[model samples]
Target: MYTPGWQIVFLDDPPRLKPAARLPRRPFQYQRWEKNIFSRGKTHTPVRRTVNICPMHTLSTISSRKSTQPFVHALAWFVYASVIYSANYLANPAIKLGDTVLFLVPYILTFYVSLHLLQVFSRLGTIWTIGGVALFMVASTTAGHAYLFVILPKFGVYVFNPAHPEQFAKDALLGFLLYFSYALLYFFADRNIRRRIAVTDLRHQGLKRELENAKLRELALRTKQENMLQEQAFLRAEINPNFLHNTLNILHAQAQRYSEELATNIGKLSKMMRYSIQTTEEQPGRVTVTRELENLQLLLDIHGLHCKDPKLVLMYIDGKPDGLMVPPLSMITMVENAMKYGDLTDPENPVLISLIMRTNELHFRCRNKVMRRTEIASSTQRGLANLKRRLDISFKDRYTLCNRKDGHFYNVEMIIYN
Candidate 1:
């Protein structure tokens, strides 16, 4: 009637904390830089702080890096382009402002279209931007003075003389060349600026992901620590009940027969109790396999005096690396339970328990021979249940417990990772 360790394993699996516990409550800080600038005996201390407020825009922060700076860059470019075009046109009356506007209109249109295309088609942004510039060049060259000539006269401006065929062909080619060259410079500068922004965004995302993973590992460790404290408190309560039952059983035996062996068993039981409860000398979770075996031996000695002869076999395999550690009293409890319930006096029905530790993993095997198919009653579930909670806090998913039945033998096994 050995209680499977797996039954207790699930009992103490710590419930997950609330969503609030997982969420970060502290305010996120922005990285800042300080600059000291002086002008005419006046000192200006500028603290440049970059905060990612808008989550969506934060991803595109590369593109918006200049957002905090002057917002009139586009307007400034337009003014500069207009002034240059106007100056060239006014230098010679033959080159009218109307003619200049017509020649430069395609270039201006191409720059805006390229920038807008980059903003929309972020993946193919650069390709579309180049394509827009190419389209502008081709369109303006194909239409030539045919389109601009009609539009200029309708607006009451004259720059071209269709009657002089030589002037029309020569001026039109010069205008196209000038506009195409300007378009190349503007598009190249704008694309370079946007490309720098996109690269910055990718770096930010990589950094953010690394930070989140670190936080998750820290939180998982903290939650494990809290669970261990709670489980230790619970296990400490069960010690009182176990001591009371053993003492009562000993007293009943003493009353029945005043024997020297019974007194010796009582003394051993007292020593085991003192060792189990002495917290000052024994650091929490500091019990070695040797100490745990001592506790199990004491339990078996007490059981031999009270119950009938209990089957016990102690084995230590060689080649096991030393300095191995285990949770306090973890293995002893399962072995103690098998001695208490199994019919060990019968040579045919014996309880077999083995402990093995190798390469940071602790394995426990407890088997008891069962005779009949009758239900076994056990009121308290604290022993193995406490073991499970302690294991979870200590090892978490790094371990497993299972119950296997082979013929008439019932086996409970626990595998723990250190």
Candidate 2:
């Protein structure tokens, strides 16, 4: 029968038909071919059978796909063995190639076998693994010496005969020493590398901890600063309302008198209030000395409208008030204190205010006859204390404030350095 897709032919038969022509009979043993052939007479032709094998399924292909670590390790050991054998051959001209190969084969086999055995034994326990490795090293060293001296001579590769006990003992000692030395060197080197890695890791961890601590400290400082600002705002809120209430009562008293002076003092009060509110809103709350002096002049004008003796409330400025800044209302606080507590009616001992500039320093002094009333004295002390706290916060160590009472005069002085 004809196969559907494949062309098959018998080598023993020759036919007169064309190569492309199909045959009706099936041969017992046939070869497959893409093209058919024809012959005119009987002829013998060799039958060729073709088998297709996938390249990926071949042994060489499969092995090539596996990891190369084992092969590389074996190659490295082989190179090491070759080097040692070559060195030995160079030292003694009598050592032959066969003898070198004979020594290397057993030495390499014993070393690798002992190493594998130790690795397996290591899984049992640390103590047992150590003891097993030591035992294996001794046994392998002894066996290597025996194979080199006793067995190799029987094959005529080694010149030393096994009958000589002294030579065998000396060679065995040398082999043991070499093996022990190599084992110790490997152990120490591995341990040293591990220790260095551990120390580096510890230092890295310490640095990370220090960085975290620094971030925590920074966060804490920011939180404390926020709290301080909020408290200052609360204190300012309390002080302003009480001050405005008292000033409005005074304005009401002046309005009842129906005087033109009340209207002018009202304008001065509005300007002072606007300056105070704007200055409070500013961060660090500072104004130029010129602006501060203008506000002070307005405040004194309003107070002068009500003073029993306006001439006794005196102020003196001894320097050019340009390009100099101070904490807002700092100088005015001292003036306000003097007017509230001093005997300004006394012509001989008037409320004296002075602002002087010396080089990079600004000196402010206020002196007045101290009121004998306990209530006014207590309020004056409280106001001065508040001013001192504000000065400490603003200028820190760059400014100085002094308060003294000499007999009848209460003196307040402050100096700020630029």
Candidate 3:
């Protein structure tokens, strides 16, 4: 694609191709050599692989609990009344239906009234609870008096003598006894239930604390492991290279006093070494594109200085690399690979390299003529694989790298997003 500020500056006169000859295709890419294999006589299209990432979350589920006390109370009341009625039947075998109904009505009222009064005053403190007991006694006595004075008359059974007023006091005494007994039973049962709930809450708190402690310990271990790995990597990257860099600087200075050419080459090598040692701090696995191009040119100059073919490799860079940060050795590895395996003896088909740095991204392409005996380019895939790994460490999925090879030439392309 043609873009403003993009140019192709060849180190030699660029070769002209036939009108029908187009560049070879690239393949799916990310952190590896994505091959785009083609059959000798058939055509194929390349497919880029994509990775989909999603976030993860943890959801806490709460189970619902229903109270069974209401059902239990109903069952207990039924059983108590049945046992009492059965006992009365044994003592008074001639009891009538009206008499049974009269006994049950008063019993049910006293039981429920005591239960409800306790429930209402349970949380109101001891003073209110004592008052509620007194109030319950009065209520039960009043209910008993109404049943004795008015309800029994309807049944024509168990008549209370109006002349003997002591019977009223005795009836109230009986009401107090029955009400207190029922209140005590409900009070004890409620206190036991509350104690169980408190114990369960404490257990849950302990388990929660233990889970939090385990998570903290795991985090600490992971942090320590990461620190160790970072230390090892730092040592490997900085130790030997730093020593060589210093030694080369000294040699360049000394060579300047004897041979200008030797000093220039040594200075270039020293700058390349320094850039490699220091580039990562600038942008994390990146150096200024200008620095990379300078080092790359120096490498080509070194190739020409040492080899018979000075124009075997041709590099073309377009657009300003002003603020752009390219990964160190991004293009140099490709040039070296081409030099190692390509048929650079044929001047007509030199190794071609091109780069374009746009507003927010970069594009790079390279091609090399394959040797006559080689069926494919990049036979071992080492240099490209290493380049892929380094870029992935820096850019992750924000970059693309792919390659294509026919019987005679190999082509590679890479795109990096800022």
Which candidate leads the pack in lDDT?
Answer: 3
The candidates, ranked best first by lDDT, are: 3, 2, 1
lDDT of 3 by residue, 278-353 (tens): 7755666877777777878877776677457757777777887668776788877777677777787888888899
Q: Considering summed lDDT, which 10 consecutive residues are worst modelled in model 1? A: 5-14
TM-score of candidate 2 against the unseen true structure: 0.45
Ranked by TM-score, the better of candidates 1 and 2 is 2
Per-residue lDDT of candidate 2, residues 78-159 (tens digit): 7877787789878987777666767667555654564555444533456776787678767876776777777876787764
The digit string of per-residue lDDT tens for model 1 on 70-186 reads 456567656866786778867765655555666556555555554554443433345664676567556655565556577667877666676897886677566655645654565
TM-score of candidate 3 to 2 decimals = 0.65
After TM-score superposition, the amount by which residue 245's alpha carbon in candidate 3 deviates from its true location, in angstroms, is 1.5
Better candidate by lDDT, 2 or 3: 3
Backbone collisions counted per model: 0, 0, 1
Ranking by TM-score: 3, 2, 1
Clashing pairs in 1: none
